[model samples]
Target: MEKIVIIGGGFAGLNLVKRLDPEKYRISLVDRNNFHCFPPLFYQIASSGLVSANICFPFRREIKKMKNVSYHMGHVKQIDIAAKKVTTSYETLEYDRLIIAAGSTNNYFGMENLAEETFGIKTVAEAAHTRDEILDRLERGAICHDPERRRRLLTFLVVGGGPSGVEIAGAIGEMKKYILSKEYPELKPDDVTVTLIEAAPQLLGAMKKKSRDRAVKDLESLMVNVRLNTGLKSYENKYVTFADGHKEYYETLIWTAGVKGEPIPGLPPETIGRGNRIIVDEYNRVKGYEDSIMAVGDIALMQCEAYPNGHPQMAQPAIQQARNLAKNLNKGEFRHKFEYLDKGSMATIGKNRAVADLKGFSFSGFFAWLTWLFIHLISILGMRNKLSVMVNWFWNYLFYSTSLRLLLRPTRFPLRKHWGD
Candidate 1:
């Protein structure tokens, strides 16, 4: 059996592993983390609507049924293409076929200071940290004596008008409206501010005009301050300076602005394309390599007539590309070209409010919200996770609140003295 080494256990790599024939190939999957995360619902985790475990599934448990597959928990340090060896943090492995699916990282656009200070929801840990930061600020704000400090502590700013930004902003807005006053009686609804800033002219740039308009309206209705055509120039000492020269004080800055491909080291510089993605052909084969090496998901930028630039870096495109590549590998030949199927785009604002742009038409309001819920619910990996999410959602919908607000902090135990001490 040929050895197949795949990096990343995200949507692309995980799907590809599942599709590949166990008898024909020996598969090894490497990732920094030991579990797969549902990124779309990360905002819910940040907002205390769902916990991290609700969306994350262990890789070992997932691949246990596959006889030919093994999971390695480590980060890929470098890839030696000529020798066909992958050097990870823990071990070095040789492969007959190498697949790169290392997804993406938060793009701070050279703003290093902002990157360090701001919270990002790109990963499970980041989402948990964001939730903790928000709650911490709220607790501090409740007892703060200084008026300005208290105001800043209560103010939350989300940069980026895309789906992640919109969803998180809306979630925070809903929290401020429905949960804040009840949970923290010291802080009124008016004390908290949820602001969403978009550099673009409108929110949800990929969606239709109607959907974008609906999103803005819904956000505004939820008491979120939507700021369009506003770009962040700098962030210093809890103050964000806009491109327009105006500055605003914010305690928390959640950056959902952009994501660049998390390309592995050792690849030729020329192969790296826009957004740091590895340029590939229609068959998802990496540039300069014939068939032994390939890249899929957000890391691969395959240009075509339909997508002249490249397919949108989304879950659907990643899964589709992975499936296509898996089929070709299983056949022992590259018979099919990867073509992206643009399913649709959807963003949920708050309860009974969402926007969905489907194939034939676009819609907003309660039905769109339901469609969003149903689609995400079914797309989740594990049955137990799905049930847990469903239960959490049902409870939240019925009570207009969630009880998963406990701040999960690391327990710091005192160091035990040695026998001599």
Candidate 2:
């Protein structure tokens, strides 16, 4: 039996395996995580609109039906190309073929300290951590009596004007208006400030001009402080300095600026391109090895006619490429080269404000928001998870928000007795 080893088990890896036949190859999937996190709804989790369980699906549970595919929770340490084997934390994997689906990481733009200080929504655990961080600051504000401290603590600085940043800031904005109002009366809606900083002049620079204009308008309507043509240059403890000689002190900073590809060892430095992505041909195969090894998702650089620098590093492109590659992999080189289909892009501002740019048609406002919800709900894996998320969304729509908004405790605390001190 031929061994097919996959490095990462996210959207790309899982989607590739979905099209694979059991009889042809004995599949071995390796990931650092045990659960597959649905990336799209991570913002909902961070904003306290959804729970952790709603966004996380067990990969083992989902794929236990396939007898050929064996899932393992391990990290890939190194790959020995000459020996045709991989060194992992668990064991050495000798593979007949290799697929590198290792995804991207948050780009701090060379600012390492800022990366450490900021909270980014990349994984399930990061989302949970962001939620806890946001909640903890708010709770801390309720107890702190100092006016300046309260002001600093309540301010949330979201870096980048991309979909993730915009959506997160928007969600936090909604939490302030609808939910946080009913919960914390002491703090006014104005008290909780959500700042969105972008290096570009307009928000969602990837979208159309009309859509970008509408999105900026929608966000400004929600009173999200929009700073354009500004970048985070340097940072200390709580202070962030921008390129334009402007700085702000923020207690909570959510990073969504940019991302780079996951590290691949034992590869020549020349093959690596911008964003640390592995440079590959349009066939989704590594530069030299067209048959033996392949690359996909955010890590792969499929520079083509439409995308000279490779496709946009988004979930849609990754999933589409994976599905296409899987079919082509089974069929051989005679198969047509993969071309990305542009469905659309959306950014949700608060509860009712959203903008979507389709291939020809563009939409905004309440209807667009509804479309966004339905698309996300459908994209999520598992019937049980979809139903749970739908029900919770409806519940949130009915009631203002959750009454049980407590900061998640990662570790249990011990009982301490207080005498007559």
Candidate 1 per-residue lDDT, tens place, 296-366, comes to 99999998888887898899999999999999999999999887889999999989999999998999999
**Residue 196 error for model 1, in Å?**
0.5
lDDT of 2: 0.83
List candidate 1 segments past 4 Å from native.
411-421
Q: Estimate each model's TM-score.
A: 0.96, 0.95
Q: What TM-score, to 2 decimals, does candidate 1 have?
A: 0.96
lDDT of each: 0.92, 0.83
Looking at candidate 1, the ten consecutive residues that score lowest on lDDT are: 412-421
Per-candidate count of clashing residue pairs (backbone under 3 Å): 0, 0
- lDDT (tens digit, per residue) of candidate 2 on 1-421: 6788888888899998787667777888888887787887888889888888887788888888987998877777788988888887778888988989989888887888866788989878788899999899888887878888898899899998999999998888777777666887677777788899999898898899988988888777777888888888887788988897877898889998898998888777877887899988777878777667888899999888888888898888889888888887676452867889988898888667889997789999989989999998888888999999988888887886774366877664555332101
> Candidate 2: which pairs clash?
none
